[model samples]
Target chain A: MRHVATNNRDPEPKPLSEPVFLILTSLADQPRHGYALLRDIQDISNGRVALSTGTLYGALRRLLEEDWIERFKQKDTSRDKQAYQLTSEGRRQLRLEVERMRQLARVAGARMKESEG
Target chain B: MRQTSMTILWLYPAEYREAFGPEIVDTIAQRAGEACLQGLAAYAAFAAGEFAGLLLGALREWTTKWTARDGYMSPPDFAVEAADVPDLQRRIQQLIRGMEFAIANHDFPKARLYSDRERIMRARLDRLLSAGNLYQSR
Candidate 1:
């Protein structure tokens, strides 16, 4: 898998774990609970990544712990299901990641185009 | 009103309903009830059962994750279990002890036994966590 990161003088940012990155991207639109988030990701990816229940929830746990995202609300009527929203920090991190990937793609595009010439 | 027996829960178990809130429940209830009104015998049963089955399955998955030392299971090999166990031999003994508890109550439902097994699982899980990233090691 191709990894992209910001080449800031301070330090190279770590690659977002693929599942974590994709999850964040999916959430950029609106708040999503766990299962809905899973569906959205599945739909967006066209089934390229079918997150197993374990992987989905595990990523959620880490993402919550890191303050990348947070529990937006708990469903009282529902049995123990909770919804998550991205934190401000999470949004910023996601933006940074997207930028990094864009940069990589731009460079790749130029190189590929040049090769044809 | 006719005694409408609707298996409207075409949606079934609810995924514990935590994430979805009332919306999913309403969906299930409405669907199940509608099925009853329509007199769809097999469809209602299948839908209701599925609703329960899927929700429970998801819940089971959720519980397993919370209870597990890792999100996914790897074999209880030396590398993963060894680090946390400290003395692998002794740790294995502890796991056997836990497994004994897990399998000890061979009464009825293995599903029911999970709570009991959880204790042992939790202990072993703790050891696994302390042990190190077994996958990376290999």
Candidate 2:
């Protein structure tokens, strides 16, 4: 197995990039392939942002490196074509990101609604 | 002929995948048998690039201040030079040539590997790339 040195020993780390934060979160619900994940992010963002190939693969690698996500593709098939899925760590990270977003939304909503009224 | 390698190269996202769509991946299993030198290069290059991109992308996001940018300016002016994606086809083709030459002549070929290195370098680019100014949105 190829190995990359770990940057730090933290057990639970935050998503390093927006792409990864989004990618891992996307799979929090279910596993997906390269294109499918990109489409889902686009759908949710309502086209405000789209993940390019570089951004998509970039986050996928980081998530894998941190052991946050595991490669789901079958390497035994002897082909480089591979797929990936969220690991337990990845799921936890996704949950944190979701809650963080939720909290921010809640605060923003109260302020905006109160001001309008 | 090396043209057959094109089938293998086509399996990767940019050259064949983006151009031909998902059809290439379906056929990759059938055509990958003893593929020529160029095809092997394409496969390795794609994987290497994918690995590099995944690692660096996460690192950048982990470091960037996504929330801090909110309500700061008119629009986020992110740096484009950092956003550029290297040409995958050229690197893959070169890698194939390097390996083929090394195998046929029995020596290390540095050029192809160098090309691969350059592609990988951009992923880990050290400078901070700001997302231009700032833009507000929900």
Candidate 3:
């Protein structure tokens, strides 16, 4: 395995990149190939975050390395048409991230209400 | 136009080029054919992003090599031996040449066959590289 050494080893999972988050979310529902993932991510983000093929693949590689996603060759598809699905660990991480954001939003909403009042 | 797309693809690592190079080029070609000038512009932007990705991929590969040590990082069980890279690279080049020749002759079926071989070779290299097999093969 290639070893990338970094000094920081935080136990907490950091917020994902836009592409990565969208990717995980897309896969949370079903496995998807490169172009499909791109389309789904754009739709999910309301067309706000369009990922180029390069960006999508780069995130896919990292996710695979982290065991957050698994790649498989679809039996019906050609060899070049690779697909990815979220692993159990990936689902847990996504849930955690969503919860964290939910809490932040809740606090922000309360603050807005107070200010308005 | 095809040549330009091919040149852009060359920015990627050899293995990466082997794996997805054709697909990316095909996408660009399709865009060029369908959208005309606008598609070419889109392809340019896409190629630029891919160029950045190539650099990023290199950085990641090198970093993995650096941080990989006993108990330092948990590398996947498979590793590519440093020695295997050259031969694999050669094979990739050969396959690519065959693909190009077949494509030039309009033998698309043969071209696809070569393309599949290239993909398989690239996956093997990725596996070896992932396993931290950094040592020379011999």
Candidate 4:
């Protein structure tokens, strides 16, 4: 195996945690409020991961701070029903993370094939 | 039980609470019956996780500020939104009540908790006031 290095000053983006990845995935389609996100994320992950209120809000705060997501109020809803949507930056990051996972899966699949052969 | 859960929300840092408090409380209240339906162990675990998550969130907020993370340079506009000032003032009043109650009961630790949240709320107000000064000068 060989490795190559480039003269980029910035580090490569890392994979997101399961909850964060799932949150972004859920929001990829449409904006959601806190409880809606909780429900959607559970559905998306086959009920394997259920985010507590504190954890979900904490991730939301970080995402807002990172400019990866944005909060907005809908006219039809009250303040407590404020919804969040993914930013362009968030979408880009989500794509990158999905690609990273895909690549890893490919490698693992190939390794399995080689062992079977 | 609902009021007690709302108080558990106070365990979070004031900044976090201010930003998402109502929604979180609403979410918990909406789901409380279901959690009860799920059985005691499940509810206990969820409560435990919520407290732990609050601690983790506070640590994260402190660390991110200490490290001066990106997108944290400018405080959010709502940080000083005029609409929030009254709410913040009301919260400060409540915190004082809490502190007084704690002290009356000789609960030093609980008093400290109220004191700490009050300090945080005041600091946020101070920052908003200072920002107002700059806005006025401009």
Candidate 5:
């Protein structure tokens, strides 16, 4: 067995990048393949964000490394059409991010209302 | 266009290429097909952005390969019982053998699949061994 370093730990959870966040959101509903992820992300972002294949795969690799997403064999799909889905940990992280944004938006709205009044 | 993209994919690191090359190619081909339906200009624009993205992504993957310690490759945080060691070891061995066979046959995608499974099993094995050592020290 290799000398496994048990001391290394994950640091604090930083905010996910737009691409990462979108990718997670795309997979939140169900598993998707590479092309599917690209289309879904575009739809979710209302065509504002068009992820290149390279960008999509880069984020996928990072997420897989983090265990936030997992690859699973999907029926009726070719071997090359690898599909990915969000894990429980990924779902939790996405929820946290949504909550954070919601709170920020609420505060901003309240501040604007006070100024208007 | 796909041939061009396939050529560009070679710029990525071997591990990354083996893992994602086909999927990237398939996605690019699909996008290209969609762009073709719009017009020549649209297809050209898509090609330009796609190629540039592939170049930058290759650079990023190389940087990650050199600098990042993959979390999955590290020792796991979960505990493992003594009895689970043998089963984990067996699975790891099976996965490694499968990976090797796939590699030998030039089935990189299949090899990558085996490698991913093997990595998880290896992590579990490490946890079990670590747990045993901790027990011995006590």
Candidate 6:
């Protein structure tokens, strides 16, 4: 029997950039198209991160290339309304990112308390 | 404004433009609409930002293309279909040729990049084949 190599190892997740982190977080709830992603990202950041369409699509392409997201077919298959959803890998990465942030915050809080005392 | 935005969109690499052009245009239109509601200053700022972003994005994408790290190397989820086997094979052949040419030219870095792409493509091909999807041998 020929041994077929299975490339199934999950590599350790690196710390994500801010835009990537926001994009993944936006898709954590449900699938969204280009415009929806832009709006939601802004809303998520409380209007601080207003991504231009080019920047948004650039990030989307990278996410797709990483296999962390996939194009979702919806009834509205109009030229501009293609939706995207997070893959399981993407969700796992997001969860890991959140945990990383929580731990950092915890450490910072402890140090602040020690300083105050 | 839409026309100007489209013109800027044209500056992006052909593959990137084809994949996301219409959506980017639509998004820009929607953003412009929202900006229109906020008054002239907001709309002006939005237009300035949009043009600058698109120009910078086009430059970056073109640079990425020249650097051999475009979509050709990455296995996007969409490429998993069995129907893509032939296309994948063709890409693998091209990568081999590219690697050989790079070696002949003493461009070892480029050759290594091609080698990496070949490995990834072959792995993807193996996965598709192992899934038991019948594809015509090419």
Q: What is the C-alpha lDDT of each candidate?
A: 0.53, 0.47, 0.64, 0.70, 0.76, 0.77
CAPRI-style grade of the A/B interface in model 4: incorrect
**RMSD per model, one decimal:** 14.9, 19.9, 15.1, 13.6, 10.7, 5.2
Could you tell me which 10 consecutive residues in candidate 4 chain A have the lowest summed lDDT? A1-10
TM-score (chain B) of candidate 5: 0.54
Tell me how each candidate scores on DockQ against the true complex. Answer: 0.02, 0.06, 0.09, 0.19, 0.25, 0.39
Per-residue lDDT of B1-138 in model 5, one digit per residue for the tens? 789988998999877787778889988998999999999999999999999999999999878767753322232211122236666666667777777887789877667666665665565556557856744532
Whose DockQ is greatest here? 6
Q: Which 10-residue span in candidate 6 chain A carries the lowest summed lDDT?
A: A1-10
C-alpha RMSD over true interface residues, model 1:
15.8
Interface RMSD values for all candidates: 15.8, 15.7, 13.7, 15.2, 8.5, 5.4
As for TM-score, the candidate ahead, 4 or 5, is 5
lDDT of 1 at A13: 73
What is the Cα-based lDDT of residue A64 in candidate 5?
A: 77
Q: Residue B101 deviation, candidate 6, in Å?
A: 14
TM-score of 3: 0.58
Report model 4's TM-score to 2 decimal places: 0.65
Name the weakest run of 10 consecutive residues (lDDT summed) in model 5 chain B. B73-82
**Candidates ranked by TM-score, best first?**
6, 5, 4, 3, 1, 2
The TM-score of predicted model 6 comes to 0.74
Better of 2 and 4 by lDDT: 4
Candidate with top lDDT is 6
Error of 5 at B20 (Å): 0.5
Candidate 1: Cα lDDT at B123: 39
| Greater-TM-score candidate between 1 and 3 | 3
After superposing candidate 1, which stretches have Cα over 4 Å from the reference? A1-10, A74-81, B1-138
What is candidate 1's local distance difference test score? 0.53
Give the alpha carbon lDDT tens digit for every residue of A68-97 in model 5. Answer: 787755665345457898866689889888
- Model 3, B1-138: lDDT tens digits are 557657756655555566556655554454345435567776567556655654565566446546643221222211222236677777777778877887789877667656655664566566556655654552
The 10-residue segment with the lowest total lDDT in model 2 chain A? A1-10
What's the interface RMS deviation of candidate 2?
Answer: 15.7
